[model samples]
Target: MRTSPPEPLAAALVEGRTSSLKEPLLRDGRLLWLEQRPQEQGRTTLMLRPAGGDTAVELTPSPHNLRSRVHEYGGGVYAVGGNDLVFVDDSDRCLWHLNLPGAPRRLTTPGPRAFADGLIDGPRRRWLGVMEAEGRDQLVAVPLAGGEPQRLHQPADFCGYAALSPDGRQLAWVEWQQPFMPWQRSQLWLAAVKQDGALEGARPVAGARPVAVAGSGPNATDAETDTYTDTSAISVFQPLWISPTELVVASDASGWWNLQRLDTASGAWQPLLPLEAEFAMPQWVYGMRTTAWDGQQLIAAAAREGAWQLGRVHLTPDRVGTPAAWEPLEQPFDDLAGLSAEAGTLVALASNPTSLEGLLELDLTTGSWRHSPAAPCPLQPEAISQPEPLWFAGHGGVRTHAWFYPPAGGAHAEAPLLVKGHSGPTAMARRGLSLGIQFWTSRGWSVVDVNYGGSTGFGRAYRERLDGQWGVVDVADCAAAAQALVAAGKASAARIAIEGGSAGGFTALAALCFTDVFRAGASRYGVTDPSALASESHRFEARYLDGLIGPWPEARATYEARSPLAHADQIRCPVVFFQGLDDQVVPPEQTERMAAALEANGIPVEVHRFAGEGHGFRSGSVRIQVLEATEAFFRRHFQR
Candidate 1:
């Protein structure tokens, strides 16, 4: 049988039309995952595939979003135990449970409290998760039989990644105080679990302590202290127990987030694999898994030099010498997530330039793999733009990385270059096939994704390059990358444009205002005023600017000097702004004010606002509308 040829890449590059699958959970011979279906009224549903079954079962019914809004970037939304699945409903922020093939039943009361980062405690018949309520965050246990939640440990500004020991005798979690985000400085805590499932005798690992904590009470005066004064601060993420007295975690104490093992009996941490690559990621959302450990081996994903790779490590009871090299897993993915290990089988979400995101299962012994909801290449091989990894000297000759995707066809001798700044000033741009980037490249444009200063995966020094230099360092690196591309004849020097959302949007605006590298700019709910963001943002990132730009009032001059709104007159090129009316992170007013400023400065400006949208657009039609508007706007100015 012969298959029909694929349609044009541009025609298939509809924004938000493709489903994004995440968080693969394997247990009891079943595969469970989360599927965010934008076409289904932007509903994010849970799915399950029984053992040896080829069809996927839609476990989440209508109007029920298996999502949690905790920390505003929800993750750890669902957990599985035997034939039951526990999840957080986005509508009311309550825990819900569903026996296999049955309708979901509400398990917790609906209220102001938000629950996320859930872990299934089968031994205790409870759900261990991070709960935010009444102005404090705590790790708590909610009984599966439906009862009042019991607070497990001391409260912190934020808590996440609650993992229970296999024997249910202990609990491990990650906590961090305010003024510092999880990526900045966080501590790992181990505590004894009582018969009643309450946590006690809590102690910090590696001699680390909370930076600041005013006791637990309504009368506490300084509950909002947002500074990490500890000199030897370390950030830990994703603690998983490999044995009753042993656990594996990723820590950045050595300047990179490498794997480390903590022995409860000895209270000493053993470095497993020490390298510059990151085995963990920033806990921006709950339920993010980077490393998976079976009883004897581990499957982990690490990022190095803007690319993601998979590898495995064998474990022993005693401390062993580090292997000369990691046992590399040959996979076709450049991006991986939701890693899980069951009976030596590794299941994860994998994707790359030629494939859509899907669930991947690999049998370590036989070197066999299977991809579900199989996504064959939607375009001809020649139509897909392969990314070329490039490094250029940033400001002060500091090294920086980016992935350049030239126009797929050789039809266009000179093409407009799109300088894309990814969000998470602390986040790295993983090399993968992004439909948004491909949309531009397939339409005769060259796209370069800049992993500017402060992006993760690199060593601590590289990740902290933007500390107190957010706008300055990021803007300079992005501009430098674009200039380098033009110099190398990979892009048209006269037709370069910059675009980004959130922090990335702020970089786009700064690149256009502070440098002459980009001819036009598009910002999606980008930060316009650092001072305003410091005040109006949510609690999760309210004090984040203290490190990015510095504490307010002391660095007020620098904030004013670097803000895009303050230097609007310097923007001599056309600019477009896309904003979500309901965004709490970078408020819509920031985009509105910047658009007004651009118009006042005699620069052509376009502003499009979508209602019922938040920090990011979940509606497929809205995303497509924005993409169309942005394309038309960029071409009009570039062709002029």
Candidate 2:
């Protein structure tokens, strides 16, 4: 009997005609969002859907990229108030304002300054946000009428997440200093806004110091001590004002990011729905909202055991001491973000394992919801591969999580495996239906998206596992995940490969050098040398290595020992590298040096360099090329 191979998923299904949506905002019964169109040469434009209209209209014309480069990984690019909209123009990196039926006018004189996390001060006729200039960040106010931006405050080395209280009398923002990422150690500060828009009486409201308890630390082993200290500082997330004298925020003081309310006048914190779930995510970019007030109650999205769910909390000033009444909403989405609520309407970007990312709208009054996908799924439901949650023993026997996708419509007894390490090193491997993952599965390749020990969506202790052990912990976990699949007799032990981009790329390269689990590997703009990254990185990530590996020059030997480029001879597998010439985060030199070293060692190597591409490939054609090249390279190597 002759058996035929399964049909492969099209490359265009993963790259072409698909647009990404971000920073979804609901204002004045209108839905506004930024759409990154890959087919249009990766230009991001503003989209507006009228109050009751089904079609969305483009507001920003050609070449007007509504992007911010403040931290290189920019977000919170646009803000709206009534009819006025403010955004950062990527071409000039300057702030621009656009009112309906009028052309956008430049607000600030472009120089080395870049702005993000913007908020409109309609009453004061000014725009407020974080401004980065000369390697320092400060809260600045740019007048809508045109002039120099006023420096409102420089509380620390970095500052963002600016929020104004109701009645416009008080200002609230989050701040953190060097050597600490915002998710690791950040403070919530509040100040009075003067009649002239100057800040006064600025004082820390929360996240000032570490949370300690009597007789026990979070990981206490000593019994003799009367008091124990926890060294990790409390990290604060998005602050939203619920009343004139009260505001709500998420703080990781209880080992999880739980919602809490603060009374400004009395300096007291009240617990709101203190569950063992995270109400916030890592602050990689600006303007990340996990909780929103819907005029009657607090609507929040929380992560529990690697999946997300939406819930509501009922609390008021009179019920301060009582437990909050929590109500969970039954929805199909497992991943959610960019939540915005107004007048009993809730909108967010959401997706599940069987669907693409879409704009989800929920009517609180009627308890009904509707989903509008960013793009239609090109494949049928039966062709999709569902993710099965897998828990494997990771580095040092610690339990780790991952999503395993079996080969779809294939009769192979032992399928080849592709292990993926997600970027951010702090990021999680979500259970969304990624067409990229499906492209391999539909072609009879099993896949595992490993959420390493240091990944988020878990408690703080789990996330800190990679602290000072970036290359070692991540590499071990990825290898363990692949080995687990092989042990289960579902995948071939000799035909497994690993691939990652950015930090994930570093993991894949390091695994090839230090472990023999993978037969081949691929890296996209990966960090081959941590020492080089410490010296050549941008301002936002200058001190990021302090926690990841250690201080740069002080731990110089550790950096060199763990770098993949420093030990390229140890890698015995054929490798392929993809790089962007203009990547400021992980420069092209990192890829060039590693590829050169592998070639010198007589190992099979392929390098693809895109001239205008930066850290991430945005053009549809380039994405298609990368996908096809990677598949061809893997096939060629696996056969040998």
Highest lDDT scorer: 2
Q: Write down the lDDT that model 2 would get.
A: 0.87
Q: Provide the overall lDDT of each model, using Cα atoms, as 2-decimal numbers.
A: 0.81, 0.87
Q: Candidate 1: deviation at residue 607, Å?
A: 0.9
lDDT string for model 2 (379-482, tens) is: 78878888888899999999999999988754243788999999998998998779999999988898999999889888888889999999999999999998
Residue range with the least summed lDDT across 10 consecutive positions in model 2: 212-221
For each candidate, give its TM-score against the true structure.
0.94, 0.95
Please provide, for model 1 over 157-181, each residue's C-alpha lDDT reduced to its tens digit, 9 standing for 90 to 100: 7778878888888888887877888
Off by over 4 Å in 1: 1-8, 210-231, 320-325, 373-376, 411-413
Residue pairs with clashing backbones, model 2: none
